[model samples]
Each structure stands twice: as structure tokens, then as C-alpha cells.
Target: MYNRLTLATLASLPKTITRPRYAREALRPGILHIGVGNFHRAHQAVYLNDLFNAGKSHDWALIGAGIRPADRAMRQALEAQDWLTTVVELEPGANTAQVIGSMMGFVPVGEDARAIVNALDDPNLRIVSLTVTEGGYCIDPATGSFNPEHSDIVYDASHLDAPRGVFGALVAALRRRREWGLAPFTVMSCDNIPHNGSVTRDAVAGLAALVDPELAAFVHGSVAFPNSMVDRITPITTDRERTMLTERFGIEDKRPVFCEPFRQWVIEDNFPTGRPALEDVGVTFTPHVAAFELMKLRILNGGHAAIAYPAGLLGIHFVHDAIANPLVRGFLDKLETEEIIPQVPPVPGVDLHDYYRLIASRFANPDVGDTIPRLAQDGSNRQPKFILPVTRDRLESGADVTGLALETALWCRYCAGTTDEGEPFRLDDPNAARLTPAALAAKDDPAVFLNLRDTFGDLADAPQFCSRFGIALKSLWREGTRATLQRYLNDGF
Candidate 1:
């Protein structure tokens, strides 16, 4: 039996639950990680925990920081346990539990980012890492570039001293560093954006330019934003997971992360100041993280987008269940093989088809318990990143976008916020309020949703794209999600 997990209970805990091998008290802070969520904890923290176990980079521990008020709950949960997190690695046959203590501290979330600003001033903090999701970057969907005119950017530019956003916090930190004559630390983005490094550099430099051109020049020159490709199948923590820990594993861990056995991190080896020796712990440091990024984003992420919306509309709850449906799985396979994969460039040492095969197997893993809701959330943000890029590639190449166009129309029907049975499932998204209205209007006028030119651009006006999309939307409403999917699978387009 195991009691609630805390540093004090480390001695009595079962040996099966892997504990940190190094001395926790001696571990010092080095990286300040923003957005300490499930993916970050499962993937990045696990790697650091491995390095700490290997007795390397003792000073390279993480100090978790949060900008959103919602993060306080995570802070309280972790701080209550002395910054320890229980990570359960879910494999095919068995699961393993491990306690990670690489994060020794946290910067409290607040309206003004002063706490994080002050934390960054410390010379020991050599890298500011973030996993703030793709939406957090504030890139305009019309163009794959940073949106400097975002309301947050405008607010931060004026209230630089009392800023609230991530870029605001970054600007404050760099300004402090420059005034104190400290060399600027590297900014590493672990998000799933194409050219995430360039996006980070653009957001920071763009905001800094508004504040001060000289400061912008300093930021543009001094900072090193390295692009990376990180992968792991981590699901939302459910009561089932908690019970599994308490009953099967004989441990009580609040907010424990459960993830797949596999993990991969491919990073561009560029940190001007310094970084963790993560390469020692199965992290691939390479120059062409872009290639890896494109491969993962298009093949894996696009695959998720392909199945996610239709799955949600069909009321499929779990990822495995969604992919298990013959129609859903067939749609994913046909779309990728016929339309998506051909546009992806050849990556070094990676067979694109083999990657797709790996993704297929990964999607079929039931132990991970990845939810369709998680994959389907934030369609306004996710579709642009995961699905639209492939559509654009096919469009540019003059390939038949019939499958891609149908996929977009399926997304349009999904946005209408109802299933074939007219059952109302809440559309969970940041833009749900606006998106729902546009989607509802599109029910009457098949092309109304396309007018949101910022997202669809001129493709909403293109005869081929719009016609296919309109047909798919009409069929989706008239027939149902399953019949529509079956039609597309049968090449009824």
C-alpha cells in the first residue's frame, strides 16, 4: 500500500515506482519552462529526469512558470508534493510508474509577469523553454506569419512594465538582461508549429520592435530560438488513471501523467548560452529539425486532424475507438496516402511510408487512452496548423484536392455543433462563440463559413475547392457523418 506521494513518503514507496536517482535538495534551477502541462511533463521532464539520473546537468533543473491564472492549480498540486510528479509510462503489456523531481521551483502566475521577469534575471537561468500550444504563438491564419497586431501584442506593447502575455514576459526578461549586462538566454519552443523557432523569434522581435527598435535589434541579435520536433502519446489524466495508480500500483499520486512508452525529441543544436546534455538521454540534436517537424506535423498531426472532427461528430469518445471505426480509419488512410504524403519532402533516414505505418500503430494503441475530444478541441486553431497546410500544398502542386476539400467540409459540418442524430454536443473551443454562429449560418448557405477569409483565404472563393466543400457539407447534413464518410471512401467525389 502507498500513501499520498510526497518527498516525505519517498522512502516507504514501492520500488516499482521509480524515484529520482539524484539528490533533489542539491539540484539547482537552470531552465524556466512555461506552460507546465501534460505533454511537457510526460516528454521533456522525463528526459531531464533521465539525465539527472545519469548524474549529468545537476544545475540544469527546471523551474516551472505559468502566465495564465488557470495554472495556479497545477502549481498548488505540484508544490504540495514538493514539486514532484508521478509519471506512468503505459506500454503494451505493462505500465511503469516513475517520480520526477527535475522541477525544483515555480514562478507564480499573475496579471503582471513580474515574478517570471525577476526569475529570468537570475544568471543561472540559461534557457527559457515553452510548450505554450500552437495557438499561443498568435500567428495570423491567412498567412503563416506572426500577427504583431494581435490585441495581446498591442496591450503588451503599451503596458510593458505590467504585461500579461508570454511575449510581454519575454520582452521584460530580455530588457532586464540587457540593462544588467547579462548575455541573453536562449528561447526554445517545444510546440508543434512549423518553423516554431522562426515563429518564436518573430513574435518576440515583433513585440520588441513596437517597444523599442534598438531593443528589438538586441533581441533579434542576442536570442537563439531553436526549432524542435517532440513526440509522445500522452492522454488527459482521468479518475481511471488515478485508481489504477492507487489500486494496481499501490500509490496515491494527484495529477500523475500517464503516457505511451515511446518518446522522440529532435532538436536543432543551437543554444548560445548553454543547455542540458539531453542528447545523452535519447534526444536527437540535429540541424534539420525542420524536416522532422514537417514529417511529424503533416503525417502524425494531419492524421489526427483527419480523424478527429468526424470522430467527435460520430460521438466516438476515445482515439482508439475513432480509428477503430472502419469508415474513420479508412478515411485517414486514403486521405494521407492519396493526397497528404506525396507533398511531404523526403526526410533524412526516415521513410515517409514507414513513419505513417508507425503512426497507424501508435493510433491503434488502446492503453494510452488518448481521447478524441482532446484531439478535436480548438478546431479554429488546430485545423490551420494540422490540416490546412497539407491542403495548401496539394493546391499549389495542382493535385486533385477532392479528398482534402472533403476533409475541410467535414470540418465545416463539425463546426455546426451537432451530430447526425441532432444531439447537441458542446463544441469546446476558444472561438466557439463566433465559430458556432458562422458554422450554423453555413448550414443554410454552404459557402458562408468560407467567408472567414482569415482562415480560408482565397480558397474559399476558388471554384474547385468551394464546389467540393459545398457538396461535402450538403451531403454531411443531408445523409449523415457515416454515410458521407463512406461515400468519400468509395471515391464518390
Candidate 2:
């Protein structure tokens, strides 16, 4: 009853699984991670937990910090559990759960940024990892460059003493380290951006150049931002997850993270200062991460975008439900095998067919419970990264972009805030107010929506793309998503 009902007094639960010997032992801070979200827990923290379980890298542990007030809630939850998390991976035949104890402490962004900066200044802290979402970087999606003129960044440039954003905090910390004659920590970006490491380098160096040219040069020479491709379908936690762990698994975890069994982290081998032997725990360190990154971005993520909009429009809730429908699944399969895969560059040892099949299986995993609305959030930021890159490449190569163009049309239609059943759907993006109106007005004129320079950029003007997109939009508006998808599938688009 104690183990099943209450988490606060579970003394025996810690010993049931392979506990890290240092579960209760405090270690020196060696990594200062920003944005300690679920993916971080299931991926990086899981790696660190494995390393700690092996009784290696005890001197190097994690201290998490966050920039938002929402982080305070996470900090409080983690502190209550002594910075521990339970990660459960659901597979076909087996479900496994383990407690992770890699994080030592957390620092909150507050009235004074000194504590966070001081933590980063620690010479022992060799890695400053970030999972701050794509929007957090303030990069212009279309241009893939930092918007120095962004209000927050502009504020950061003017007032160095009081920094607001993550970039601002990072710049302030690096400047302090430089002034103290300390070597810069490796900047590892675990985000889903293309050339994420290079993007980080440019954004950081670009911001630094605005404030101090000399400091920018110093960063350029010393710092290392390693690009990485991280994947795992770890959805937002729910009360059902908590109940399952307590009732079925008999582990009362406060902030448990549930993910699919599949996990992959391909990282660029470019750490200047040093890094953990993450390779020992299934992280592939390679020079050709770009191939893997491109494959994953275009196939897995792109397929996700292809499915999300239609799922949202069809009144589907979870990813598995959408994949269960023959119409949706068939459309996804045809799109990937015929249209998307041809444009993808061949990866060294990987079969693209196998990869797509694997992605399909993962998407069909009912346990993931990945919501359509969650995936549909921030389409403005997501489309340019996940969808349009492939569209742009296909158009440039004179390859078939009919499917890609249709995917974009579906995205625009999804943004209109009305489902197939004529029920009101809430748009979940900051740019939704602008995008929804434009999308609705462009119900007949697809060009009106495509001209969204903020999202599509000049790719909107590509003649072939515009023609296909216009036709798809017209079909969807006239016949609804089901008929449009059925038509495309049957007519062989």
C-alpha cells in the first residue's frame, strides 16, 4: 500500500532497480544543462545514469537550470525527489522502468542571473548542454540566422548586466570565463535543428560580436558546439502514466518520463575541452552525422509533419489512432517511399526503406500516446525546419514535390482552426493569430498563405510548388481532408 499509494515515503522502491551507487552521493558539478525536460531525462540523463551505475564519471554530474518561471515547478518537483526521475521504455514484448539519478541540483533564473552565471563559470563544468527549443534560439526560421534585432536579443545587447534569454545568459557566462582566463565549455546542442552545432556557434558568436568583437574571436577560437541528432518519442506525461507506475509497476515516482523503446543519439565528434564516454552507452560519435541527421529530419520528422496536420483535421487524438486508419497510414507510406525518399541523399550503411519501415512501426506504437495537437503546435516554426527543407531540395533537384506540396497544403488547412466535424480547434502557436487568418482567407487562393514570408520564405514562389499546392488546397477545401487524401492515394500523386 505504501509503495502503491504514496511517493514521498517509498524507501524500498529505490533498491528494486539497478540504482546508481551514487544515487544518494553528491558529486561535483561537471555539466550545466539548460531545459531539463522529458527528452533530456530519457536521453542524456539516462546516459549519465548508466555511467554512474558503472561507477565511472562520479566526479562529473549534472546541475540543471531553466530560464522560465515554469521551470520553477520542475525544479521544485525534482528537488522533492532528490533530482531523481523514472524512465520507462515501452516495447512490443517488454516494458522496463529505471530510476535516473544524474542531476545533482538545479538553479532558477530570477532577479539576479549571477548564480546561474557563476555555475557556468565553474572550471570543472566542462559541458554546457542545451535542449532549449528551436524558438528559444531566436533564429529566423527562413534564414536560419539569429535575429539580433529581436526584442529580447536587442535588450540583451543593450543591458549586459541583466540578461534575459538563454543566449544572453550563455554570452554573459562565456564572457566571465574569458575574463578569468578559463577555457570555454563545450556547447552541445541537442535540439532538432539542422547543423545545430554550427547554428549554436553562429548564434552565440553573432550575439557576442554585437557586444564585444574580441570576445567573439575568443569564442570562435576556443568554444566547441557539437551538433547532435537525438530521437525518442517521449510524450508529455499524464495522470495515467503516474497511475500505471504506482499501480502496476509499484513505483511511486513524482516526475516519471515515459518513452518508446527506440532511442538514438548521433553526435559530431567535436568536443574541444572534453566529454563523457557517451559512446559506451549507445551514443554514436561520428564525423558524418549530417547524413544521419538529414535522413532522420526528412523521413522521421517530415513524416511526423505529414501525419500531424491530417490527424488534427480528422479528429484524431493520438498518433497510433491516425496510423491505425488505413487511409492515413497508406498516404504516409506512399508519400515516404515515392516522393520523399527519392530526394534524400543516400546514407553510408543505412537502407532508407528499412528506416521508413522502422519509423512506421514506432508511429504505430499505442503506448507512446503522442497527441496530434502537441505535434501540431508551432507549425510556423516546425514546417520550415521539418517539411520545407525537403520541399526546397526536391524543387531544386527537379524531383517530384507533389506530395510535399500537398503536405504543406494540409498544414495550412490544419492552421485554420476547424476540424472535419466542423468543431472549433484551438490553434497552439504564437503566430497562430496571423497564420490562421491568412490560411482561412487563402482557402481559395493558396498563394495568400504561401506568401507568408515568415514561415515559407521565397520557397513560396517556386512555380511548380505553388501550382501543386494550389490544386491540393482547392481539393481539401472542396472535398474535405479524407476525400483529398483518398484522391491523392488513389490517383497516384
Q: Give per-residue lDDT, candidate 2, residue 337.
A: 87
Which ranges in model 2 have alpha carbons more than 4 Å from their true place?
A: 2-11, 14-18
TM-score of every candidate relative to the true structure = 0.98, 0.96
Candidate 2 residue pairs in clash (backbone atoms < 3 Å): none
Q: Pick the candidate with the highest TM-score.
A: 1
User: In terms of TM-score, how similar is model 2 to the real structure?
Assistant: 0.96
Residues 109-199, candidate 1: write the lDDT tens digits: 7767878988999999999999998899979987878898999999999998888889999998999999999989899999998999899
Candidate 2: worst-modelled 10 consecutive residues by lDDT: 1-10
lDDT of the structure predicted as candidate 1:
0.88
Off by over 4 Å in 1: none
